[model samples]
Target: MFKHLKSDLPSSIVVFFVALPLCLGIALASGAPLFSGLIAGIVGGIVVGALSGSSLGVSGPAAGLSAIVLVAISSLGGYENLLVAVVLGGVIQLLFGVLKAGIIGYYFPSSVIKGMLTGIGIIIILKQIPHFFGYDADPVGDLAFAQVDGRNTFTEIARVFDGISLGATLIAIIGMAILVLWEAVLGNKGKVFKLVQGPLVAVVLGILYFVFTQDSETWGISKEHLVKVPVPDDFNSFIGQFTFPNFKVIGEPQIWITAFTIALVASLETLLCVEATDKLDPKKRTTPTNRELFAQGAGNIISGMIGGLPVTQVIVRSSANIQSGGQTKMSAIIHGFLLLISVILIPNVLNLIPLSVLAAVLLLVGYKLAKPATFKRMWDLGWKQFLPFIITIVGIVFTDLLIGISLGLAVGIVVILIKNYQNSHFLHIRKEEKTGQEVVKMTLAEEVSFINKGAILKELNKLGDDSFLEIDVRKTRYLDHDIIEILDDFGYKANDKNIDVKIISERGIIENPKDYEMFFNQEKKENLKVTR
Candidate 1:
């Protein structure tokens, strides 16, 4: 992990900027103490990042869980009791990892995964538009369309013009300009430009602008427009920020219910983000899903023990890490340490950075995610892939992350079923050269399942009397029992219809096979039902 310190260190700084505001905003949205989010971010970065097999995935307090956290807090009677649930949830996640439930992540279709990334990208842009123009009504990390501020996504954007802060808007414009300059030209110019990243410059400029223009009537950026990390006056006050869980309510049935809920939701979100992150990885690294779950579980346990929200692998920060050229998990770990040190040593200095500058940074991240080229590429893949991709984006933009992914998965499954029904086998008919008889040859696909039963049956039933039939399974693997039954029944009917049957396979050729089930059973026992 330390081998790429030059790259990882700079990327980690970018992730720190991305994670900082999100940590505080998610905590505020969840109605948890502000410091709890920071703790989760710190633990997520340092602890989970160290343990996880993911090279680039960054975990933290998720906006997806804010609603869940808020309700759990209210229902559990207090934040302390909620922390109990969080700890239990971590245990459950660890159990999930041990059970190898990580395989579930691989089952999600590529179309849906791409859609998720695009949907998140679009959400980031939409959500940050208000902030970019100096309107901070919505919490920084909230991704849902309907907001805690009593306005929907579009309504909030509509209100942005009215609440626009000139200083913030101007600062945001300059920040965006710097980012564009760096991305388009400066970043590739020299090692110096690479070492000193554009985001770091933008943030420093935002701080300097805030410091210099505080007293200027027209140019002043107000407190409401700045990053709001809680500043502790002294050592004891800083330590007091950490809260402990109430163990007394551990036996409560409702507490267990909440714990299970958090574990299930956090685990699902992590798996999905893992899938998306792998897709975005330049090196195409595959994260060990089970290990990732175990790492997240351990992180959550540590976080909850010290007054933090439940943690998950977050896509926004992970994507930012990738876009910023992060090479390893060290970036995530160092970012967490940065969060810890910043809040402890320079909380006041961090508080001086304007929210709009962060918005500019996120705007770039969002664009890379939902690029127009991606849309056209998905469309070119045909309706089977495009439908799910578009639906997922719509669902995410209108609802939330998981809901959008669920909708896309539903559509993707239907597309698969349709494709399977149509592509079960191929049929060819020709006249025998010498005998002048019609010969029908049917070749089964590489894999035949119960879903293909109807299509295969229809083709077999259409075979005419006195015709020669040839069934080919040379390329087939893992034929389902239901499909074997259909072929068996068809063989009997074909014999009665005066159709001469010949079956070909990798094992051997059989003429007019009387017992298809027995033959397949022998093949299954030989472990011949596998793809090479």
Candidate 2:
């Protein structure tokens, strides 16, 4: 892990910059103490990073869980009570890991996964537009279409036009230019460029811009558009920030229910991020999902025991880490330490940095994820793959992350069922036999399930009178019981239609076989196992 120290260190700084505002914004959105988000970010990066098998993934307090946390905090009567649920959620995640449930992530189709990445990219760009112009009404972490501020994702964009800050917009434009120039021209030119990332420079300049223009009436970047880190006045006050869980309410049924909900949601988000991060990784390294679950469980448990919100693998930070050239988990761990140290030491200086500069950094990240080329590539893959991909992006943009993924998965399943129904069997009409009748052959697929029943039955019912029908199972290894019953019924009706039927299988051929069930039963009894 240390082999990539130079790369990981700079990457960690970019991730740190990406993560700082998110920690505060998500905490503000969740109605929890702003310090709690920092704690979760710290625990997620340091604790989870230390334990997780993921090399590129960065864990933190997620924007996705803010609503859940908000409701749970109020419903449970206090933040302390909600912490109990978070701890229990971690335990449940551990149980899930022990059961090897991480395999669930693999079941999602590539189309859905790619859609998720692109959807998030579009969302990032959409959500940050307002902030780019200094309209900071919505929290930076809110990803859902309907926001807590009563204004939705799109309305917020329109709202920004009414409240654009000259100072914020100007600095954002300059910061964006710096980022583009550094990435395209100077990023690889010298070791110094790599050591000091473009984002770090943009943020420093933003702080300086804010400091120098504090007295200006027209060009001043206001405090509302700046990064907000909880500023503790003294060491004793900093210690007072940590809140312990109230385990006294552990007996309540609602607490248990909340625990299960958090566990399920958090695990799912982590698994999905794992998949997305691996795809984004240039190395294409696969993380151990079960171990990731266990690591996340441990992180959440520790985070909740203190004053932290729940933690999960976050794609935004992970993508930042990868895009900035992170090669190992050390980058994540270092970011956590940066969060911890910054809050303890220079939070005042942190609060001086402008949000628009950070927005510029995310804009670049968003463009990388949702580039126009990706859309064309997916479109070229054909409808079978493209439908789900497009649907996932739309759903995510209009709804939330999980809902979009669910919609994509549903479409993918429908496509599979359609394919299965159509490809169950192949029908061939050979030249007429010497008996002056047509010969029809139906070859079953390698595996036929109940889904293929209708197709097989339709073909069987279409047999012409005085025709010779050949049922071929030579390549089939498994046939469903429904299909067997259909073939058995067809065998009994063949005489009425004056159709001659012959069944061919690995087991010897049968001529005009009327007792199809018995023949298959005998085959099963002898352990041939060709038909169900």
Candidate 3:
């Protein structure tokens, strides 16, 4: 992990910026204390990152769970009782891990995963545009299509023109220039620029702008536009932020139900994100899903024992880490330390970094995700692949993450059913050179499911009485029980219809086969099944 310190250190700073605002905003949206989100961020980065098998995934309090958290807190009576639910939820997640339920992460279609990445990229770009100009109607790091303020992703953009801040716009422009120069020109020229990243430089530039223009009326950035980490007045108040869970509600049925709800939702969200993050990793690293669940469960348990939100792998911060060139889990752990040190020692110092610079950093990350070439590539993959991809993108942009993915998966299943209906046979039919008889020949596909039963039946029904028919399954890997039954029943009827039947399969040639029914009906289905 330490081998890529030059790469990881810079990337950690970028993730630190991305995670900071999100931690605060999600806590605000969840109606929890602001510090709870920070605690989750620290625990997610340090605890989850240390135990996870993923090289690039970053975990934290998810915006997807904010609504659930809000309802749980209100119905559970208080924040302390809600903490009890969170701890129990972690135990449930650990059970899920031990049961090896992580295989669900492998079930998502590749088209949907790519669509999710591209859709998130588009959202990041759209969402950051307003922040780039210092329009603060919606809080920083809110990625939903519909915001808590009743404004949507686009309406917020439209309102940007009416209230652009000159200082912020100018700072953003300068920050972008600094980033490009450092990465494209200066960074490549010498070892000096290689050690210090563009984002860190851009942040420093933002701080200088704030300090130099403090009194200027037109050019000065307001306090609202800068990074707003809450500063504690004294050491005792800082110690007071941590809250313990109320164990009095441990035996309540309602508490257990809420615990199950959090575990289920957090597990699903984490699994989906794990799929997406693995795809985005430049090295194409695969994460162990069960290990990830165990790590997240442990993180949540620790976070709940001290005040914090439930934890899950988050896509936005993970994406930023990838774009910024993070190479290992050290980046995530270091970023957590940065969060801890910044809030405790330099909250006032962090307050000077302008929001515009962070927006500039995110803008580049978003563009890489949703480039025009990606849209064109998806279009070229044809309607079967493209429709689900587009639908996922649209649904994600218009609705939310889980809804969009579910829509894409549904469309993907429909496409598979249609393809199965059409692809039952690989055929080559022509008159035999010597024998003047017409021949009907069919080669089965590599895999056949029950969905292809109708198509296969239709083809077999079209065979003529005088024709010689041949069915081949030598190359097929799997033959469904239904298809085997169809062939067996057809062989019996073909004898009376005067059509000659021959089957060529790995089980050896069989003429007028009629014993398949006896196998399935009188004995076990697996007795005759052959797999290589």
After superposition, the stretches of candidate 3 with alpha carbons farther than 4 Å from their true spots are 431-437, 506-508, 512-532
Each candidate: RMSD: 2.5, 1.5, 2.5
Q: How much does candidate 3 score in TM-score?
A: 0.93
Q: How accurate locally, in lDDT, is each candidate? A: 0.93, 0.93, 0.87
Sort the predicted structures by lDDT, highest score first.
2, 1, 3
Candidate 1 on 1-532: residue-level lDDT in tens?
Answer: 6899999999999999999999999999999999999999999999999999999999999999999999999999999999999999999999999999999999999999999999999999999999999999988978789876678999999999998999999999999999999999999999989888899999999999999999987888999999999999899999999999999999999999999999999999999999999999999999999999999999999999999999999999999999998999999999999999999999999999999999999999999999999999999999999999999999999998889999999999999999999998999999988987889999999988899999988888888788898888988877887877777777778768888888888767778456565676676665647333
Identify the leading candidate in terms of TM-score. Answer: 2
In model 3, residue pairs whose N, Cα or C atoms come closer than 3 Å (at least 3 residues apart or on different chains), thus clashing, are none
Task: Give lDDT: candidate 3, residue 222.
Answer: 93
TM-score, model 1 to reference: 0.93
Report the alpha-carbon TM-score of model 2 versus the true structure.
0.98
When sorted by TM-score, best at the front, the candidate numbers are 2, 1, 3
What number of clashing residue pairs does each candidate have, in the order they appear?
A: 0, 0, 0
